[model samples]
Target: MAQQLAQGGLTGAAKLKAVTDLINSLTQDLSTSSLGPRERDAALDELKVYARDPRNADPIFVKEGIETLSKHAFDGSSATTSRNALRCLANCLLVKPSTRNIFVDLGYPEKASIKLTTAGVEDEFLISRIIFLTTYGTSVNLQNLIDQHHLADAILQNLTRHVKLWTGSSGSSFKAASQDPMTDMALTETAKLLFNVTHFCRQKVDSFTPAIALIVTLICQHALPQPKPLDPPLGSLVNALLTLNLASEQGAAALFPKANPAALCERLIQVLDKAVRSYPDRELDTAVLPLITALRKIYELAPAEGVQRVMQAKLLPTTKDRKKVLGKGQSLASLILRHTTNAMAPEFSKAVSHMLFELSDKDATKFVQNVGYGFASGFLFQNNVPVPESVQESFQASEGGRQRAVNAITGQFIDKETAPELPEMTDEEKEREAERLFVLFERLKSTGVMNVENPVARAAREGHLGRDVIDGKDRVEELD
Candidate 1:
């Protein structure tokens, strides 16, 4: 019957008549109590095809057409028939969101959410999407899905099932992808729906805690290369996690267990490294923030061993690169730091800066010492954080008293023999340089960057600035 529209070149009134006749006929057959098994499946399939085309879809919604589709979708006829019915409903909802209310008033969302609890991969994909669509213009209450129908439980269960199916007992690539492509599509649709549910009902995120650890393990176990910034499961997993409180007591337990405290974080660091390498600068501006934020949150609550592992991750500056300038190579830490200074991606840069700062425990001293004053000062100066005098005279060792062979300010190891040498300044040049320094300090003080004393002005006040006036009648505060 659908071939009549295409093969016969039915046009104008002829096409409309043919489509109307097909839909009405299918609707009648599908609604029939005595319809045979094969006839019901064929009718459902034809209705699905009819609903797919916008022009021919009006009759599907004409008179109780959606009602008929909704009945068969979960009417306990047969799995194939139910899935076919679901496709028809999926198409109608996609093409005309206005009919969402029509479907909702029929009370299928509640039924759909329940179906999700036991649905297979295909049904899971279809039902989750159908319920997710009701969230748009319809008056569907997402919290009701959480509080009333236990939708979060279903999402987590499906994610666990996907994990087992994709990776099996061994740590490897998603084997299900080669045998079947629906596995990938199933995850994408399911994740989108999960993001919606959690976004609308944030207070209920505890319901999703178990899935977080599973996602982390899945990401870690995938041995294949992370070839893109937002591949399936990676991007989807991050999206589900973005709203979750990975820092909560429950969340913390799942991530940093006692057996191997830093295992998950170290694994996530590897994932972040791949993302840094895969993402273009424009993509980096938005695609990678959640991953960065997730790592930061976990690190903030990580144990000592975990912290050490995270600091030693490729995302942070290392002494091995202290021979050259920081943020200057294709290494993971360098690429991440390169983004920290990117002007096009200010928020991305800020997140990168925050991640680095957290790795240093947010200490002003460690911040400057680890990344050098040049990098740390930019972050500090941009956010109006006043630098203490101690951060200026950077320490050469970490808190554990491990000394490093790196310049405090430049973050580079100086080979004095090969270092570029310039001539010493003459007396006049020295005086001119002092004057310039005075002017620069004065400007900095004026701008409120720091409430610092102008040493040159203080020198002049105490008569120590080229005036032989160190002797004062009223005692001036001595310069240190």
Candidate 2:
């Protein structure tokens, strides 16, 4: 019958309609088919030929044929039939637009996706076809699949499994032209597609609550690769993290409350541990901020201050000699002591203190001189934290005055070598450094520090630190 239609004996439209009617009949009685494996194979061969016919390329025939194929793919009794159905779908999709009247008439959306979703088809062949179409097929089909059906989630799940499989079996000399890279790139493209589609979908809703919820979960799971510096960049992970953080901070209250900060912290730690265990030394230089951010988010969620403190004990670095295989060194303890301390978030005090105590005597002193006062200032100013009156008073009454006095105290203890290096003083270097520091000071000024004079302004007032007087105080203040 299909061959007769292909021969063009009857009017093309009429014959195409007839084929569509037969397909619709097949869709209806598909579950009742008791064809044996051999019979199923013969039936699929016929469908495949019909799908390739030029006359059956009309939109109505294509739609009914794809629907029929999807139904047969889902029928579970015949593997050969399902494979043939997918082959037909792929061949038809690969046809030129002029010849694919069915696709053009149907708006070239992911009709297969809609059919699968509406029909609730979970057959592996249909899934594989969906995956191929989304990864390598056109944007029209992908958008339709994502928008008309909840296909993003399905793609994500499939991509995740694919990643595990490909990465697990991969060997050295990895190239996309090779089996591993090709497979991995295909999976990666799937992930990228899902991300782009989800982003577009997010704009339609007031808040991307549902889309973000899935994105966050996926980000927290895979973006942070295990064993630091493993294969991907940490910056890549930040795209997802920062997006989640910004969304939670902005109007996504449901997202924030629903967001599991603690789980996020744990997952980050797993990646960090892998990185630390893999490349310990260099990580302290670059990994500190991200780790701190993760911890801070977790600390934010702790109900009791004491709980935050305890959580710190669990998450904070304890070892001093952690180094990567390359002999590059990262001191988590040093980082914690240097970056998180008094005057800083109190959740970090205990951890910072313990680590500070472990640094080299000279290095410890230098660390204090550079960031110590900043840390002290944080502790001193925070009403939520307690500082001894003796220390506070000592900080307040010194020669340079309270702020300068604290700086002096920290400066006295710091090792010159370990003290954070000020930028080079060459004219060119100084200018760039000045701009950078101005940005930094502006940030500091905006933190609502009372009695806080801008560092550049204070330097100008003292006639010290640099020869040129700091200009644009108001502009700096405006930025602040």
Candidate 3:
């Protein structure tokens, strides 16, 4: 029919009018109760083809088509027809940005959320497409989906279903049967949707604790020593970890609240230990960042016992085989420190730094000795890096008081406080010092002893002679 419409002698507006008329006829057929299921399905299939064509993605036709398809998408009589309608609408929404708004304007997320309740495999797949479209379409679209459609509950329900299917009947038979690619795809998309949705609706996310726990359990199960062909793939596990990280960032508690903190920390640390052991070889580097972030957030929110448990898990190995498990000379702390110092991406570096800082606060003396005061001071001096308050308190309370305080201020060893009092300077003395420093700076510039473009050198030269004697006082304070 599309080919016929193109081949016809219609030109300009005539061509568009003909296509619009055809779409109108098809939508009318789809919405008519007189039409049988086969006829309606065929019309939906034809509409999907038209929607797929970029040329036919006109707002008028797409708006009409979305309305028609949304009606059938919610129709309870035939899942096949509803699935076909959903596929068509999804295609139309995928056509253009305007068409996506059209979907939202028609409240398709609400309609799709309802269909997700008892959707079959094919229907669920199509519905997930729409959900992804709305969830990730735009921030406005996503916010609307969350606020108006309650997408969090729908996605959590879907995630919970897949997690149950994968975790149930856990023998070889279950593994074999559960390894279906489609199932994994559905689970992955559902997790992604959950992740995006939770970015906006954190309180609602907290309500889905059971579902979140299931994802964490799946991660632990797959990440722990097991067999080949990780049923859901490592990417899905990473996505799950990222989702939990988002939730934890938004005030959700630890992954397992009621579980024993020591044991939970042991399990979490084991996952990291395994990944670090296989690093640069197993390509687990991608997963390690979020896993570390999730672990850090959990530790932050967990009680004192939980923080202690994490510290214990991250402690240096003593036994021969224990050290071998993390690879020779590789404790979890040292591995994270390596990444903190050397990772190519700055965000990874900051995350590792923050995690280490949190752990350090729990046992400051050990981290200060192991990771070194230099590492902590470097973190403090880095541009825009946030030194956690606990870490600040820890540093202040550590033994090397004055030197550490100076290090915190200037990232160097000194026997002065961070902000020491400066002696009152007489104007005559200040003038003399300013004249002397200015002469020294001029001699250095003449002899090329200092880079002329160096701002620090310029500041040093100007510090004494500047109009504001307060500036000179400030510089003296810095020196102290």
In order of appearance, the predictions have TM-scores of: 0.76, 0.35, 0.61
lDDT of 3 by residue, 359-473 (tens): 6563554444335454655675664445444443323323423223322221222343245578877777766665676666567668864544422345557663444542444
Best by TM-score: 1
| Model 2 CA lDDT for position 284 | 46
Off by over 4 Å in 1: 1-15, 33-36, 46-56, 61-63, 166-178, 223-226, 305-309, 390-405, 416-480
lDDT of 2 at 460: 53
Which pairs clash (backbone N, Cα, C closer than 3 Å) in model 1?
A: none
Candidate 2 lDDT over 354-419, as tens digits, reads 333322122333333333443444533443434334432212212323222332333331122144
User: What order do candidates take by TM-score, descending?
Assistant: 1, 3, 2
Best lDDT goes to which candidate? Answer: 1
Global local distance difference test of model 2: 0.44
Ranking by lDDT: 1, 3, 2
Query: Candidate 1 residues 1-480, lDDT tens each?
Result: 654564235444665676677556656665465567787778677666656666634667653877778878876558888998898888888888877998888887888888889898899889988988888888887777777887888888888877776667435346645357676668778887877777877888778777777776666664433578467656777677667767777777777766767777777677777787787778776677777877777767777665556555556776666657776667788788778788877778899898888777677777787788888898888777778887656345432466655566767654411445677556576567558767887798789756777666777786566332222222323334
**How many pairs of residues collide in each model?**
0, 17, 0
Instruction: TM-score winner between 1 and 3, please give it.
Output: 1
Off by over 4 Å in 3: 1-22, 33-56, 59-61, 136-153, 169-173, 222-254, 257-288, 303-307, 310-312, 315-334, 362-365, 373-377, 383-480
